[model samples]
Target: MTWMDEFWRLNAVFLVILLSFSFQGAHCELVVSPVVPTLVKAAAGSTVTLAVSFSGAPDPTVTWFKENLPVVTWTIDSSSPPDIAPNYRQVLRMRKDGSLTFVNVTRNYTSNYTMKMTKSGLGTAVTYFTLLVFDNIQNVELHLQPDPVKEGIDDFTLQYVMSQGDVEQQMWFFNAKEIKTDSRYSVEQNSLVVRRPKRSDTGQYTVKLENPFSTVETDMNVTVLYGPDEPILEARPDRPFYLSGDSLSLFCQAEGLPQPTAVWVFGGENLSHDGVLNLTNVQTSQGGNYTCMVLNGQTKEQRQKNMTLNVYERPSGNPVCSVQSVNRNTGLQYHCLWWGGTPLAWLSFPALSNTSSGAGNFNLTVTTSDNLNRKTITCVAVHPVEQNQCNVTASSPVDFLPAVRTTFDLGEGKIVVTIQCVSEASPEAVVSWSKGSEAVISGSTYQISNNTTQLEIRYYNVSSFLLQKYACTCLNPLGSRRREIQLRGPSISDFRLFPNQARTVVTLTWEVPPASVVTGFDIQMKGPNLPSENHNGSQIRGSSNKYRTIQLKPGSARSADVFNLDPDSTYRFRVVPKARITEGKPSEVQILGPGGGLSGPAIAGIAAGIPCSLLFLLLLGGFIYLCVYCNKNKSSRQTRYPVSRAVEKAITAQPDSTPHNLLTGGLKSPPDYNRLHQTPSDRSVALPTFVPPQPVRVATTV
Candidate 1:
């Protein structure tokens, strides 16, 4: 067993030596710093190096491929320069080390790169590089969803968009601070999502896009639209009530994304449009509920708050106190009043210790036995602003402001006299009238009206009415008063004016009745030329050549003659009698001048017919004488002589002596003296022929 085992072991050792020698001669030991399949990144349109190093070969070949297609190749100690593919000829570069480099790299140059090192007698070594050519991070923009984010009601997103570059990592920053993902915040591929945005989250947001070669960032401002919180209203001087003429101010506060605006409403109308409300000199009419409303225009939200205010005022003046009689003049009532206030004033009597609240008037009653005469009474008025008082004195019933008035009217041949009396007293007075100790009653002659305050007396004869003496009495419970009144008569009658033959003198005459109460007479004469003295020895002047006045004593005669009158001028005379109480009406008369009557031609004709008239009269007389002589018996003689006697009487009668007839010419026919004293009715059977007098015309030698 030893000889056969020994022979096989020698042959196996010899075979292991021979195999080790062959492996050593066939392959070299090649080494590389990095393992195969390494990853590399680059940005587009920029310079990059796919860095790799090997220590086994001195001259190694580096080759770059894009998707398994060769782009470029470089080798040291080569007769020709490095070779670049037609697509990458202008942008391919080679470094001194065994690493691949690219100038102005593009996205299309992303692929695997293989490096192989080989020498004449050494074994070849190979390494791989996985290249990722990414475009530069450019055109980075941050966009917000919904444009404007809403608080508490909307989900918002912040996203980034790029045009050419790729991103390896994405980050979000809020106001320069990093944002973390949570339940409310989520990070997607290139966006950050917020579940529900809030007002506190409103600010600037930044987003970053990162890769191996470059990083790009973009910023955007985010605004959260929120609701206007419940509005808070406050008053400057907080109070439930305010006095009149006081100033007030109000403020409203709210919060929102867009600044909120406030409006003040009062009495169903808008008052202010800002946060502050101002009122100067407030009044009672302005008291009511005031509402403050806040609005957010962006969020379309509104809130409101309300407050109430009250205004008060005091009475304008003091209280008034007065006393009046009541219960048939048996008792007295004291009254107090206060007026003009927002709320009713409170009135009271300090002396009586009585109060009447929430009212403006108070009254107290007492009997006459209380002895309140000439005593002072006080009334107090209480109000929110101030208190005031007034005083009054009580007095007994007495007459005051006593007055009497009298007037006269004449119409329809009747005279009326009205007498009125007035008197004032605390207790109303009773009025009574009497005429000469006789009570005046309402009858045909006397009329009483106006609660016996006016008395009217009617009479047909003015002479009888003037003789009455009326007395008016006003009586009350305390005292009595009386007034006396007397009336005057009317004008005088039968006023006449007489002119003498020369027309140079005139006489004025008037008569007063026996019942008249005349004291004197005032005679006024108006003419072209007046006299210097009257017939009664009274003086008169003609200074103005227009008029003159003469006054006579009561006992003087009724007739007055004016001397030194103009012969060619006319005159007018007026006489007014003065009575003890009043003046009578005036009586007027006019006296004509010398040439005021008949024309000159008529006078001449009358003178010419005088001779013919005398001749006719002579023949008529002769016939009458013959008839009388032939009738010798008594009866025959009486009958024939009646005509003759009448003729004789007409020739021998004198002119009338009255001033009226003397001023004018005498009557054209003779008047019967027997019928002068008879009335027209009594003398109807044997009426006398009356001829009116013609105006006097004196003969002038021209």
Candidate 2:
């Protein structure tokens, strides 16, 4: 095969491999950088880091060493390296890229570091790092104390610090034996806390200081310091509300002879260096307890305090409610709502339907059937504050069906009436009956029949005149209605007014009572008034039954305008209402237009009383409502709730007691202040001493 043919065949084979790769992730390749770099200024107990690049794999292996003595190998991970002391002393960090680090390196660990790349082919490449170790990073320091700073846990804080350093300074805590990196003995910043304590943490501890130039070892005594009592965490504002960038002060009160050093922690990270803690911008995440620790070779102590941080947010604007009428007969329901920073909960109805609206709203619904007139509903929003709550109320208009208070009686009759006619009109209506323009007497001879607005002349009426002309009139302000009486005996002339349209078929004339025989003369008419055809008003039919009523010559007029009409007509018609509780007295005849005739005194008295009775009913309703209000709230008259009880107590608490001190002494024991220096004897070195020297020289010569 030609070269091209062979290449194509190989290429085809590769395609099959590529398809397999699609189903599975590609295997990873390991790559390392600074293949031949010279590392500088590496400090002890601190990491000198480099990069490890990888591709196409689940996990990559990176093994590092200095001069092959196996200082430390990062064989399993892409990031973390285990502690191993070696002759050449190498620390390998397994990472694809950033934050690749050497944790807690020692001065003795400096040498040429070589990295091996083993991927896809034991691909081996060696990199040279000229390691430089140093001991002089000015800003680093360390101290040992009780780990949690509590009175109980054996662990203590081992603090090491550099006043100023080029990079982060790592710290390691090791007793005479092995490395224990469990939480009981872990490292934070430059301090090692022995959380899970063992007696092994009490031996001669060694602290190694390293830089790229040299490494220094400091011997330490991890003696047990009596841990402090539990710390009381305190603050000026017990319930804290903090704005961004505001100055907030928090203090930890711990029980110890020497004052405890305080460290603030947030989001699991420590905010302390050289015993100084500062907060710049406050956020909700900044809330937490602060730990104060105190320690030396002999004494260790700590305290923790809780501080709350609140972020301020404005309340939502007033809420709007919507109401609609479903069925007017049922009633109205009002909805109220508002939004705020703090979550709002269930709503309440402190006001009755008649009282209107209430304060402090969440979402409230009131059952009220609105009268067709638009009703205004009010809603209020309330939220919690320190001592008192804040509330804002607003009103909006709503529509609902009003309670129907129509005077509910319909006069029943033998006549057919459509009840539907009442609902279709704007105002309600009333029904009555009349004959030849005269309203019929409501009694046995002229009774109503059927179940509704129907009227029937008594079938028992032996009087044949019962079959005379009559009308059924339904009255209302929107309109008025009257039907022509169905004539029974003969054709009758009927007329009515317009706006006040009625045609009275009868004219009136009454017997002049002989100043004696008059029992209030009966001047009855065929209808509500005198007829327009006065003289011909008298109808003569077959017997008295067919005779239509006629006007009394003395009392009649040509027009039906007899009501309130004067000089032209002298007659007026009136009917006493049938009594429900009392027998109604008959009405007396009255003449219009102020002649020698006037309305009877009884009629005038009845007219004046109708309005006065209505006022009495209103006053009665008001008195009943007042009685109910007084009865409902009889005890513990407190109408408002209070909120600041806890805040008041925190202000009255006491301040803490702890001493402030700095100790300077010998490395192993306390210094004796009384005998720090021995006085030099001034009377010394006498002639005796010179003579003894001369004698000794002569004896040696002999």
Candidate 3:
């Protein structure tokens, strides 16, 4: 209590003295001026004033404070009018009205300020002010960690940096539009984070920094480099195949920032660096996988696409040609084809009548003509791109005409001549034998036989009547052909043998054989002393005594002379005819003696020889009569016709069967009347009836 009272007594005494001083200072009237602002705002790096005006009788002193702490002190002087003593001299100043001013305002200068004005005779007056120095976003800029946004990628940071300023509020803008925070985008103190940026998030990014006193903005452009979405490569033709000499073009496309670069790769090698690849002439070797690669420099990302290209060629070689139809009426039809070609070209048959087949084939139709066998048909096919052409040919078969062949047999003293026709045909041909227009039958005079492709005619007991025209016909469904033949045999007449004066050699003579069918002759002779029992000389039986066979050389003389004959002995000679295929019977034997004349029994022989010779003459006359009559009516008969002109005579008269002196008796005699030609006109002259001459025997010198 005692300490409290002592403290109160001192406080009361001090209070009484302070009241007296306040009364006296109040009468002096220290007042601040009116119309002064208590708060101030300013831009960073710019001047601002906290206005403090007073109406005091004496100028008041000013003191500045920041955050309730003393900052600067100022007073008015009559000479200087204002004074300043600031904690930071370059920042704060004092005016005569007790107001505070900032020379260069910054964010650090934003605070509450109080100005205290006092004088010796006036009461104390204080003024309060708040200074909001806006940091005009100094050096405020929006920045990206990668500078540009990466499309389809992870988060990217967008930051705003201020060199010297404080921001109370901020707003982000993209392309002048405000940006907000979302799952894809976020906002931190001064940065904007974009999570998983897409291609759509590319544009100008702006930041608006605001304080209580001022507003400012900064902008930066954000580019989102998008990826080349599986770069698309396409061909100009758009087809999967190309010809070897065709033109081709390829285009590569992509979307990206910084204008992505393009690369084309083929067969593991880089082919082009442009967005489009052009090929003037493509080849088969140029076929392979084509790759298009697009690179984005800003994003450091690449995309690629691949396409397969193929080059092909048409088939090249000879075409296949086959016969489609063949017949007698339509001749031949051929089909030409070229298969397995990529692009089939038109086929043509230049030498024939060609028609197009619906497919890549050609047809040729031909008609029968005389020149068809001599002409050739060719088929040609050209490929679209091949250098060579396909060519083929067609031909017909052989065998269309008839050929005739003939043969003869002389086994039983009579001749049998056979004629045959041969030919070939597709279908079996019908063969037949005919005389003139009438078909020949299997009968006595003519025997006809026929097979599929041949005709045979057998003539039995051949005579002048058998030497007639015979025809062989062969026919098929397609066509027909015929062949004719006139067959005959040899005819020998005027047979004689004369002995030389020395009686050693004898010459044999005869008329040329009929029908040139005689190929040769065989002459037989026996010695005067014969082994046979007959009184007249007879020929030896075996081949041992036979004369050497003689061949009729094509153009040699017809006479054959015999040498080494016995002068004083009787000899016999005979002749056998040789034809194309057979030998004729031997003629009657003739007798020779040392007198170079016939040697035989005269008196007895005359008695028999006359009758026999008479009979021979009768038979010869009758045979000649028959040959004439038959030849005259040959045109009317089916199996009769004129024979070949090669025959000189068809009938020969022989002596009677008694065979003595051969009826001449070795004497030079007159021509016999019975020796007449077998034809009518040649023997038309009336002749005396033949009479057997008396067989007079002349004695031969021995």
Give the candidate number with the greatest lDDT.
1
- Candidate 3's residue-wise lDDT over 525-581, tens digit each? 654433333356553332224443432422123567777555556566766665543
Error of 3 at 301 (Å): 2.1
Candidate 2 TM-score, true structure as reference:
0.21
TM-score against native, each model: 0.35, 0.21, 0.36
lDDT of 1 by residue, 110-221 (tens): 7777766555465666677777888668998888998677788889998888777888888898899888999988989889998899988899999888888788888999
lDDT of each: 0.67, 0.40, 0.62
Q: How accurate is candidate 2 locally (lDDT)?
A: 0.40
Q: How accurate is candidate 1 locally (lDDT)?
A: 0.67
Q: Select the stronger candidate by lDDT from 1 and 2.
A: 1
Which pairs clash (backbone N, Cα, C closer than 3 Å) in model 3? 25-121, 25-122, 32-54, 32-55, 33-53, 33-54, 491-514, 515-647
- Worst lDDT 10-window in candidate 2: 693-702
- Give the poorly placed runs of model 3, Cα more than 4 Å off: 1-139, 314-702
Which portions of model 2 miss their true places by more than 4 Å? 1-224, 236-240, 243-246, 257-261, 272-305, 319-335, 340-349, 352-361, 370-378, 385-702
